[model samples]
Target: MATFLHRLGRGAFRRRRLTLLLWAVVLGIAGAAAAGSGSGSGDSNVTLPGIEAQKAYDVLDEKFPAANADGASARVVVRAPDGKKLADSGPRAEVRSLLADLKDSSPRVAAVADPFVARTISADGTTGYAQVTYKAKATDLTDADHNRLDDALDDARGHGLTVEASGSALAPAAEAASSEAIGFLLAALILVVTFGSFIAAGLPLLTAVVGVGLTMGAITALTAALDLNSSTSALATMLGIAVGIDYALFIVSRYRSERAAGHEASEAAARANGTAGSAVVFAGLTVVIALVGLAVVNLPILTAMGLAGAGAVVVAVLVAITLVPALLGFAPERVLGRASRKKSGQESRPKTTASKLPAAERWAAFVLRRPWQVLLFSVLGLGVIALPATKLELGLPDDSSKPTSTTERKAYDMLAESFGPGFNGPLMLVVSGGDPAATKTAVAQLDRGVKDLTDVAAVTPATYNPAGDTAMVTVVPKSSPSSEQTKDLVHSIRDRAQGVETATGAQALVSGTTAMNIDVAAKFSAAIVPYLALVVGLAFLVLILVFRSILVPLKAALGFLLSVLASLGVVVAVFQWGWFQDLFGLQTTGPVMSLMPILMVGIVFGLAMDYQVFLVTRIREAYVHGADSRTAITEGFRHSGKVVMAAALIMTGVFGGFIGGADAMIKSLGLGLAAAVIFDAFVVRMTIVPAVLALLGQRAWSLPGWIDRRLPHVDIEGEKLGAIPAPSEPGHRDADFTPTH
Candidate 1:
């Protein structure tokens, strides 16, 4: 691995112009393809096939075409001004006119139902709602369509009525831009501090941005042929930029270290690519493996997300190994800090005594001195933070979870206040069977049974299709959509469905936005254990290959799990339990987003293992080169500690920037990922790992003889590079070299 990478890096450096041109060409091709293909829509359907909600949806799609299963819908909630009633002649005329105008608002407007005709007026006649249906899905709606809808809404508000629009078709309130800009700025600052040169600092940022553009362009281009989710682009951007910067940071930092150690520009670039680049590749592969493992859950949206994110990481790895070395070939001496440049091109020796060692080495020495206490306290602290995870409840976010400033949220509040929280989440009961009469009887029975059930707010009479082969009934729960009681009610109705079927000889299934979201949450929940097992198992194998040891991989995986759970606990505390909501700019809190746990596990696991591989690989490298375990720990920290800290801080800053987003899911994701990086990078990898390994001594690197014999060697530490004599050394050969190991 080291020998090949050395040659590759040297080739790229010597032919720097060619390498840079290749990357530019790739980016240009991707951008052109995306431009020609244009933008695409996302697939928000996450319902599992076997679930009741999905089954109900299938029935509706087959038997009742009028349900408009694929179309978008909206509710325009209108309230009369103070001292006014919607039923009054004057207000009623305005409301009727508003509904009439909605029909001609846009060509995409499929249908509009009046409040009076649909009997949607509030019992007090103070508030009413009109239903607007669009011919296309929400993602397919154009800016013109939105403008027309807005014009219609504005006209209604022009009267004395208080009008707000909610639902899927309202073109979800414009989201605040993601944390990319903030991430870039923070990464630039951190890189500048780490490298102490504006030019050098910009290399990582430059490579990262290029990698992101390439990945995003490819995603956009492919969207023309695929049903990729819109969120996939955002996620890919986040991971691509982050790993791109960090990967480049590793190689650049190592190159400078080599330059400071008296290696010439070309040799330093090759050596950096051979050693740090190997770690970057392994780190990147771990992330890719963890993300692509999302396919195990068998959901298309998640699969696309994982694949897209993994593709970004792969691009980052390629850019780091090639572009970075090529760029370094330009002016390697300029990358050196002023103090490093003053050393006049001589090899530097390591400081022997603790007092003379760098701060990282001194910290390692201090931890080794009291390994037991450090391990105990670090483990206990993480365990305490993980306690909140026990009470975690999962649900998808709704308008109620949006910021109060959004019209959707205001509309939701108005409807919930006037009608009841249940009005926000009506469950649709679909009854169908061989006999039309039997299906009608089943629908009637369901309505009566559901009404008698506790927590039932109201059950609408059954509406039958023209064939009378299918019937639909709407049941409203007393609780909000995300509430535990609503989920329980959904389950209760499904349980009672069997009796209704047995009596009337018809099939009854439950579905609606609320029930469908519940099913989605349940599906994600069930996938957690399997997804975790897959990521951890694959990561464990990858680590074994990288480190050639069992205990180290075990320790790395366990530490990652600890950090991930602790991060999730914090997410639940903040997003679900409503603790310190104001601190995160949250207007309200309920159940945490259903997929956040699995998402956190996949993403955080990859990043955690990344830190683990980078940190531990250095220790193993020192040990393999004949340093004692204790000395190796100190040496590894002395060489790699500062870079690791800088990488983690950049990753944290990038992720933390998302917490400021208006979207609840994005905010939760940002916070969860940021917190995980902090815990794993600072606490687990840095503190607990060192303490635990210090106690284990040489045994920490032990592997069974049989396993070692069968395992394929992966020289991730670039140990073979030792055979390649430095330019300053005697008997050095420029052309041909053989790897010793």
Candidate 2:
């Protein structure tokens, strides 16, 4: 592998212009393709094929087509400002005129129901709502369609009534692009400070942009055939930028170090590519494998998100090895800028032994002196953070979770104020495939049973379809859609409706936004164990191959688990338990989004492996050269600690920027990832790992001879850079370092 990388690096240097030109061409093509194939925000529906709830949902749609059409329904709310009754002649006439105008506005407008005929006026007579159904789903609606609705509502706002339109079809404000821009700016600042070179800092950002651009294009094109959610591209961009910068930063920093050590430009670039670049490849694989392991859950949205993120990582890795090296070859010395040159000159002069060891190395020595204390402290701290994970709840965020500034949120609030909180998400009961009379009687009985249940606000009479086999009942809950009481109400209704099914021989199925969310949460919860096992187990096997040590892989797996749990616990506390909710601008508290756990597990685990591979590989390389475990630990920390800290900080900032987005889900995801990176890099990688290795001593690197011999040789630590000389040889540095094996 080292030989192949060396050849590739040397070739890239020899053909630097050609390599740059090739990447330029690829970038142009990707940009054009992405522009031509505009992006899509995925459908809001969470479909789980083969699940009982899904089957019930499908049956309800089939039997009661009017209630579950392909289109979306919006509510146009009207309020009287002067305390005038909305049922009065002036306000009522204006609302009627608006509804009539909206119904005739566009071909996309399927129908608009009258507030008077539908009895949608509030009991206080100061507020009322009109229903507007479109011909397409919310995600499928065109901009022009939304514009027409906006125009009609604008014209309808007069005559003592204020009109506001809100519905699923009206898209929420997208803050992802702005958030990414902020993240990039912050990353650039961090990079410049870390590298002390504008050119060096710019290169990683450029590589990340190119990789993300190409991957987003491919993801956009993929939407033509696959059902990708709207947030998938944003997520892909986030992961892509982070890994791209980190990967290139690693190689570039190594190249500078080699150059500073007096190696020629080409030799320095080649060696860096052969060493840190190799680690980058292994790290990229860990991330991709963990991401792709989302397929184990068999959920389409998650699968799409995982694959999209994995694709970005793959591109980032490729660019790191190919484009980054070629760019470095173009201007090897100048890439590090003036500050680096001054530092290199200072290093060239003779130095004392104390100055040779950096602060990180000294800290390593300090930790080793009290390994047991550091280990116990880190474990206890992580355990405390992980406590809240035991009470973690999972569910999809509803419309009410949107920012208050959004029209959807405003509409939700207005409806809840007027009609009750349950108005936002009402449950539908479908009784199908039975005698018309029998179904009606069964529906009536079920309605009576549900209306009497706790947490139920109202139950409407059964409304049968034109076909005698189908009937529907709408149940409204007193609590909010995302509340535990609402979810319990849904389950209770489904369970009790079975009695009516037995008597009337008509199947009763619960189908609505609340029920669908319940099903999604349940499905994700059931799949969590398998998803974790698959990702962790696969990561374990890969690490074993790379590190060639059983204990190393075991330790890495356990550390990753701890980091993920701790991160999740933080999310549960902030987003679910409502601790410091005001700080994050959260209007309400609910369960953590159902998909957060698995998604965080995959991303955090991969990232944990990323640091582990970079840090441990250095230690292993030193150990293989006959340094004792203790010396290797200190040496490895000296070599990689600063870089790891910079990388982790940059990643944390990038992820933290997403918390400013309008969506609560995105905020939770950002917080969790950022928290995980900080803990893994600082606490786990720096403290626990070194402490564990110190205790393990020589056993840390042990592997069965037969298993080691059979395993594929992986050289991530650049052992093949040159042979190690004997410790007794003249000018040998190994003897200067104390051995504690």
Name the top TM-score candidate. 1
Candidate 2 lDDT, 457-533, residue by residue in tens: 88887778788788778888999888889988888988887888888888888877788788888888889898888
For 153-218, candidate 1 gives per-residue lDDT tens digits of 899889878899987777655656657999999999999988888868999999998999999999
Off by over 4 Å in 2: 38-40, 140-144, 154-158, 174-177, 342-357, 434-441, 500-505, 582-588, 723-741
In candidate 1, residue 31 scores what lDDT?
93
The true-versus-predicted C-alpha distance at residue 542 of model 1, in Å, is: 1.1
Q: After superposition, how far is residue 14 of candidate 1 from its true place, in Å?
A: 1.0
Overall local distance difference test of candidate 1: 0.87
TM-score against truth, every candidate? 0.96, 0.92
Cα shift from native, residue 568, model 2 (Å)? 1.8
Instruction: List candidate 1 stretches off by more than 4 Å.
Output: 347-357, 727-741
